[model samples]
Target chain A: MNEVIELLQSHRSIRKFTDQKIPRDLFLELIRAGQSAATSNHVQAYSIIHVRNQANREKIAELAGGQKYIADCSDFLVFCGDMKRPTDSAERAGADVIRGMTEQFLVASVDTALMAQNVVIAAESAGLGICYIGGIRNNPAEISELLKLPEHVFPVFGLCLGYPDQDPNVKPRLPVESILKEDYYREDEAMVDGFDETMRDYYGQRTGGTKDTNWSKQLSPLFNAKLRPHMREFLVKRGFELK
Target chain B: MNEVIELLQSHRSIRKFTDQKIPRDLFLELIRAGQSAATSNHVQAYSIIHVRNQANREKIAELAGGQKYIADCSDFLVFCGDMKRPTDSAERAGADVIRGMTEQFLVASVDTALMAQNVVIAAESAGLGICYIGGIRNNPAEISELLKLPEHVFPVFGLCLGYPDQDPNVKPRLPVESILKEDYYREDEAMVDGFDETMRDYYGQRTGGTKDTNWSKQLSPLFNAKLRPHMREFLVKRGFELK
Candidate 1:
């Protein structure tokens, strides 16, 4: 396999990072790579903040569900979905601007996400490790306040980057057949059942002993748990009409 | 700059692609990269289908608003938010499988998108160019029927990838300040004004001495006219209870 393929196939989330500061130029290059991603209709409705200050990183780590790895990483970036940029531009251009509910918000979130993922790959290719911190949304208001985000902008996620200090095991995924459908999307019962062994092996690989639980066993509670309740109201409060 | 940074910083959507086939090993690498992306709590709620059959690609292209590039590309991939896999697993485990209209759906969508971006980066790193086809959602019913997508899965987008047959200018993006916030999300009007020259330069460069318009002018109608109407209902029908 080609070098790029090898890199992609071997990618694992690096949680522990060495205290090496990513060079300023490489940091800029990471953002540049992110900016090069495709935006909806080329509107580019996203922005990223490279949080390098130790104090700020510490605060962010606390904000992102007290994850120390966030603060410990050399580079911490917050990706935001922004609508105000274009609206402001339209206002400045003396043109009528009408954006609400659907594409405006969706485009920004998706665009930001795409750009962030590009940063992840680029960082990885640069021999850096990255872990995305979606837990930032757990306290969106605080994140916005900390980042000074405007009403039309909200944090989609945070990314921590640095050289890997520890090598995490490759997390298992559901079978491609379970996820990939051909000419139409259909559920495969057998594929889902087979995913149990993979999940069990993944858990066993993570720890010496198996958890003895399948994917559904681990995830079923999450549906009725704390993660779902606040997300909708949080999005609404962040000014995404979500209509 | 390192090679990876250059690859990312110079990224552009290639709408025109050669008809050569992507190597199977490279395809496997791209899919693995897609699988490597972080999922919401590792639920990994996404899947993709590689459409190599030319006739099927043509039909998808026709269904997706006559974007000939979809059919002409070496490979066309459809990314989907898959809840069925987990739901079916839950059913097998004798747990009540509820597809709530909440964060689960959003997580699935975001997860699918995150994986798609990884695939895009992997493809690009392998010297392939890609164009994301958001037009797939233009007629979701036909795409669903053609792809045999089940109820709990929604087609987020499609991607056309191959060697580039054309070299498009690097699309310009808003300045960092326009989107990035400092402490809290706040809109700095001056920063946006500073970007007008940048936008104008991008427009001029893109048009090659022909007529050109600023970003806002070009994108407003696309949001208001073409995509706004059908997306909400389409999403709802796809088992997203947008309560």
Candidate 2:
């Protein structure tokens, strides 16, 4: 109904970016808006690392499954879920802090995601385009070593931000009825089956008839291959325990 | 900065709300905005439960650590991280889906948070206020059973939305420097100390000098007390396994 809602609805990830870099002031302002997102119990458990070195950016781009936009974008930031800052600070202040609880992991990850989403909205609204690099988790151990992340902090994702050089259609989503339920969780099998048809049409049209996959079939590569099977060991080694 | 940026920076949690209910269409529109957020691999691993029953809301309010606002708000939405639908769909399509990789848990949780944050922005933009209810995790078992949530679906957080009856001052956040680093993970104890001072002043003013606490001291109850220690078992029981 408003410009803000319109902005939210029109969000589409941009991979190709123009050469113009975001001004330092504007970049910092985006972080400010991100910090304004609500944090659980005011823990604010997150850290954003701005990768400025060209070599590091290139390395990360490859580490994140060859996503070249990470190196090409004006700025690439690694958003990390950090329990270290809060728990360490609390301990130093004389509280016998607990560490490595699963709840802590959940809260920190959720806090980081919430903060980053605000950054995305703020960036998109300011005529900047952004892409979330979930592929970074594919090589979390090496990426963390490269960035010198400490114990109790794991990189959740990377974000690439810049002025868009290309325009793409907004990807269609599952209908609202399929995900939103009243009072209790209900089955939405028929709705999902209908969505498969919708996606088939979307992919066909978007790819000029080259791609012939529906949403369900498209998930085969990710689900059947045991995606990111090493993530548990990595997180535990990074002090999450996830217990 | 534009109005969208201003709105993002001006966010504050509203615990007290007016009795006026949001129109049905507007609420659904907010969900639509939420679905527009980026999902990892287009998994769209989330579900929003609209708890419209009066008694259920009251029970949920108590379950979420006695937050009466859950019962009083125009709507209380439990944002659930759902892997069941996606994995099941993939299996039905003939893929041998791996059930509970830790990365699956991370992606689903992140997707849920990103989606809910979008809904929050849309609600705030529409002149409705929201309070995130992180306390629901305190007793997730009872709450999940109450909502009849199936396996592989876990409640991540709740959102209380309505027209504000009280306009609280925007809560101060840690300076961007504290959370935003350059190239590496850096120590920010000094910045955190400075923010403690800022929060001290904010709380003093907000509570008319009745509460005397800094951010560090305020974290004692949560960290020192081993907040939500049962979450690991609860999540495992709910099929997250987090393995």
Candidate 3:
């Protein structure tokens, strides 16, 4: 693999960070790199809220199930799936704008994800560490309210960026054959079993035998519970309609 | 900017592709790079369908609204947002698996986008070109059926990959101030207005002065109509209930 492919492969989410602040210029460059991602139909349906307010960060930390990094990181950003700008631009051009279509919701989320990943890769390449906080989905309505998100805008996730205080090994992934199929969708149960063993060994060694579970075993809690059941109504209220 | 950031920003959707195929080893490396992307709770909820069959590729080309690149590209991949493997593994492990939460839908879509973007970057870095065909959402059901995609899996988008047959200019983006906000969500109408002029020149020059469109005007058709209104029901049929 080339340097770019190697960089892409060597990604690990950073949780602990040093007190070093990212310079304003480099931060802006990361955002520009994000904006360069391929967007759907060139409709850049995403926004990032740079949460610099300490009080707001603490509240968001509690709202996201006590994720203290949201408050402690050098900079925290709320990545939002936003259709308002594009739709509003269309309306201003005198087109009869139809909002809240399901595809709009899907496209906005995908666009945000693509742009955010570019930001992540760029951040990693710049010797800064970053972690994506999916915990924001834990309280989307409150997070959106805190961010003052308007119609056709929803908080998709948050990110904590800073210089690393701790380093973690890159977690292994499913074998390529498991996810990449030729011509049709298929299952790879054997691959999962093998990956579970790999994860078990990694977790045990990483935590010095404290974290005992494998990947398959760990997923039980996630699927056994109806995670984020409130998100549907919350998104609809935020004008995603999703219908 | 460093080499990685430069590569990230240099991205352009390459529609025309040369006949040279990507070597199998490099192709697998691309998939491996995709696997390195972050997944929610380690639930890698996505799959890539390598469309090797010419007939299926042609049908997908038509199903994706006459996107001939699906057939002409050396490799065309259907990136699907798949929740089956994770949830099914959970169920097999004897969890009373709850399925079809809206958050699951959001996570799967985001996960797929992140992984696919990594693949895009890796491909580009390897001197291959790529295009994301969002038009696949137009007839997702037909395309899904053709690909034999099972329950809890949905085609999010398609990718066309090959050596470049055309060299297109890197598209300019909305100014950083427009999307990168401070503490709260805000509209950047003024910045967007400035970007429109930039795009006007890009589109005209890229098409030899034949094309006439700016960023805002280009978004009119996408928002003026309820794009892909059938997606909700189709997703429901595919077992994404999104509830």
Off by over 4 Å in 1: A52-56, B52-56, B186-188, B205-208, B223-227
**What ranges in model 3 sit over 4 Å off?**
B207-212
For candidate 3, list the clashing residue pairs, or say none: none
lDDT per residue, candidate 3, B118-237, as tens digits?
A: 999999999999999999998988899899999999999999999999988788998888999999998788888898899999989989999998888999998888899999999999
Model 2 chain A: which ten-residue window has the lowest total lDDT?
A218-227
Which residue pairs in candidate 2 collide? none
What shift in Å separates residue B195 of candidate 1 from its native position after superposition? 3.4
Worst 10 residues of 3 chain A by lDDT: A86-95
lDDT of each: 0.76, 0.94, 0.92
* Candidate with maximal DockQ: 3
Ranked by lDDT, top first: 2, 3, 1
Off by over 4 Å in 2: none
DockQ of each: 0.53, 0.86, 0.88
Put the candidates in DockQ order, highest first.
Answer: 3, 2, 1
